[model samples]
Target: MSYHNPVLLQESIDALAIKEDGVYVDVTFGGGGHSREILKRLGPNGRLFAFDQDPDALENEIEDERFTLIPENFRFISRFLRFHRIKKVDGILADLGVSSHQFDEAERGFSIRFDGDLDMRMNQKSKVSAKEIINSYSEEKLAEILFLYGELRNSRNIAKTIVESREGERIETSFQLKQVLQKYLPKAKEHKILAQIFQAVRIEVNEELDVLREFLQQMPNLLKEEGRLSVISYHSLEDRLVKRFIRTGLFSGEPEKDVFGNSDVPLQKVGKLIVPTPQEIKINNRARSAKLRIATLKV
Candidate 1:
């Protein structure tokens, strides 16, 4: 099967306003879909660099002279680009969150429907996996992940149940974990709750929130003056950080104003937030929760 079907393809590409001779970076290069679109817009003189921590993505790397695929986490985007002698770029595009390929492969263990080993590391090289988080994390830590990352309302009870159940045997698989949380799973909303649980595990395994903050901090320095940034975030936590960073150059609530009564933000919002059309969502259900935010770097 195809690795992934890029969400908001055209909308994201259009937001970049690609220049024929400009340099660009696709910070999340799953399946090369977005990279291919960017390459098509670039002239021979233009250059594109793509990053994907998943070793699986390297299989889809484009064999083009103008394109360079970096098989590493985008959290170090600036460091990697600089190593390639690229100080600044015309634009950067990031489609954050887990890719469809990761979820579909049962062995990768990203979905609740799968009865497979709980291993949700985006980078196969990573030491921690969902299995570790499920089996070893303390009840307090588990509750924190469920509440903050998954937004689960009954996090305390769920964490308590997990700790109680794991005393006899290690929770080894997705099915095992599901069985432990069965009581908390609402009958009519089982899938929804299960998804939330899996999401929480995945985020913890990958340290996604920390990675996102690190990547966003590098954007202003990586982008040239007036360069664009088009990011698509799937969950509220990710969206909140992106929105706050664009508005105030901070991931928190608000920025402190300078003595001159001006906020020292590096980015200027480009337009209103964009979402997938009903047609697009119908074609790819994963696009349903996707939110695109665009901004341009201040000179």
Candidate 2:
């Protein structure tokens, strides 16, 4: 199966306002779909640097002189770019969240549809995995992950159940986890609820929130003056951080004013938030929850 189908392709590419001779970065090159599009718009003088933490994505790397593929987490994007001797870029694009390929591959344990091992590390090299999170984390920690990341209403009860059930037997696989939480599963739309559970586990296992904060902090430093940043987030938690950072240069609250009473926001919102069109979502259901936001550096 294909690795992924890039969501909001045209919308995201257009948002970048690509310059033919400019440098660009695709922070999440899941399937190389977005990278290919960016490359097509670049002139021979232009360069494209793509980053993906998952080693699986490196298999799809395109052999182009103008393009460089970095198999590293995007949280270290700035450091990697500097190592390559590129100080700043004209534009940057990030399509956050799990790739369809990851979810579709049963072995990856990113989806609730398939019964597989609960190992949801985007970077397989990472020490942590979903199994560790489910079995090792305390009830309080588990409840917090489900409540904050999954936004599940019955997080406390679900966490309690998981803790009680895994007292003796180890919960290792997706099926086992699902069976343990069967009682909490919604009757009419059980799949959706299960998905949320899996999502929460995946987020915690990967430390996604922390990575997003690190990546966003590096964006202002990576982009040149007036350079554009187009980010597509699939969940409210991710979107809220992106929105807050872009609006106030802070992740959660207003920017602190200097002694001169001037705020130091590094980015300026380019336009209102953009979402996939009905037509686009009709073809790709994964695009339904996507929210795209564009920002430009203040110089």
Candidate 3:
């Protein structure tokens, strides 16, 4: 399980303002890159817990007395942490979206560059997969996913084409889906368009946005006063949610205010948004779109 270096490693961790004796959670412990760093900074009394639903990630778990790896999705962070008798934490870090390992593995079907089965389940045990969404979903439903998740303007035509093509033969493979969508893939922007299409399918299959919402809603209650949240998001959709939630404590719209014009937002933004330096992006192309946002529970 080879994973790329964690994006915004130093910056995101710095946002945590770690206390040597504090407890922390790395909610996306892909290859233990961030967790290892956290452990390095922690003292003997400090504790670190990580979560990853991917079976492949389990192989890369760290061997440290103070660190615990939870073999479950981060959306259940509150429940699982409760089971461990942990009701609050000093900081929480999330490196959101798919990991490099998931995209590099041909069988995962997460990469548009690969020609593999449409099995983009982060958790192998998940019931729904890209295959089921592509082949079984209705044209209208498919169109909605593409428009909303992929932000594709021509989603209706794409959905109509997919529904028609799959009628002749089931769209089981990535290359096969590409072939069906070839007419829409202009050479000038083929890669970008294909990426958007695949992104839509992957998000739908994984219920990523819903899971994110669930995980975020738990933050206010889970974090102690002034507890930190450091998140790195790859795409605009995820970034928007984090930005909005941090500012207004709601995914959309402004928070309600009383007669005094005071709104009770749960979290406050710590600083301006951060992105990977040109040097970092040069080293790892995947870091190009990474955006780091820091927040803390409002006092």
Candidate 4:
């Protein structure tokens, strides 16, 4: 019922530049907050499709005939949308990262504040969970996830600590993992460091970065000419990928150019990056790290 207020709600919807009778997709309909707003802007003929892999999120489905909620991951956006007889949408909006509801439900095991099970599967049926990553992953692999996803510099030491500690007792819960890596979490930066560690494991369990990359790669072909894409990402990793793809049409390296020196990039940015105002952050702390980037199919 009370999912975190969708981060950058007004700004994100506005970025879509909605048309009264156009088709659109909300690829991360966690709470249906943005989907609701898009509906408000649509006329009788306008249609909106949404995607959410989490079983819990399906409970918040909208009843409107104009809206359809697809219970699948956005990484498969192309396949599912085609099933609905949709080829191109006028716009696509994505609110990336974990939702507040996921964090609040201690049983879901997303928050470090709660001493819950170490399961952080966005999709309840997911085979991998944070528990498996933390308790069963190789030390080298764990270090790689922590360093790359969490951006922790001392990842090797953290991985070593986890491997050593798990040898005595299996780390099955959030608090257990925290206790095992106690030395890495100093008093001043404990929360931040722990959050990063959790983030890394969660990302690995969910394959978040890979999912984002797949979703973005489909955008160029998914949207109609001049169709808009509005994405709100909560961290640097996601933001960087979105920024780079919109610029180069490729996740990494420079876009190849023709002999005439014109690079064939698919999307052009619509505006400067948008972030929450201090006022918005004051109202919802979750909005603090949100960054919005808007883009449209290049002419």
RMSD of each: 1.0, 1.4, 0.8, 0.8
- Model 1 per-residue lDDT tens digits across residues 147-251: 999999889999999999999899999999999888887789999999888988899999999999999998888899889999999999899999989988987
Q: Write the per-residue lDDT of candidate 3 for residues 1-299, one digit (tens) a residue.
A: 25757888999999999999999999999988999989989999999999999999999989899999999999999999999999999999999968999999989999999999999999999999999999999999999999999999999999999999999999999999999999999999999999999999999988999989998999999998889999999999999999999989998789999999999999999999999999999988899999999999999
Q: lDDT of all predictions, in order shown?
A: 0.92, 0.91, 0.94, 0.93
Task: Please give the distance, in angstroms, between residue 87's alpha carbon in candidate 2 and its true position after superposition.
Answer: 0.9
Query: Sorted by lDDT, highest first, which candidate order results?
Result: 3, 4, 1, 2
Better of 1 and 3 by TM-score: 3
Candidate 3, residue 75: CA error in Å? 0.7
What would the TM-score be for candidate 3 when compared with the true structure? 0.99
Instruction: Give, for candidate 3, the lowest lDDT window spanning 10 residues.
Output: 1-10
Q: Which 10-residue span in candidate 1 carries the lowest summed lDDT?
A: 249-258
How many steric clashes between backbone atoms does each model show?
0, 0, 0, 0
User: What stretches of model 1 exceed 4 Å from their correct place?
Assistant: none
lDDT of 2 at 122: 95
What would the per-residue lDDT of candidate 4 be over residues 52-103, giving only the tens digit for each residue?
A: 9999899999999999999999999989999999999999999996988999
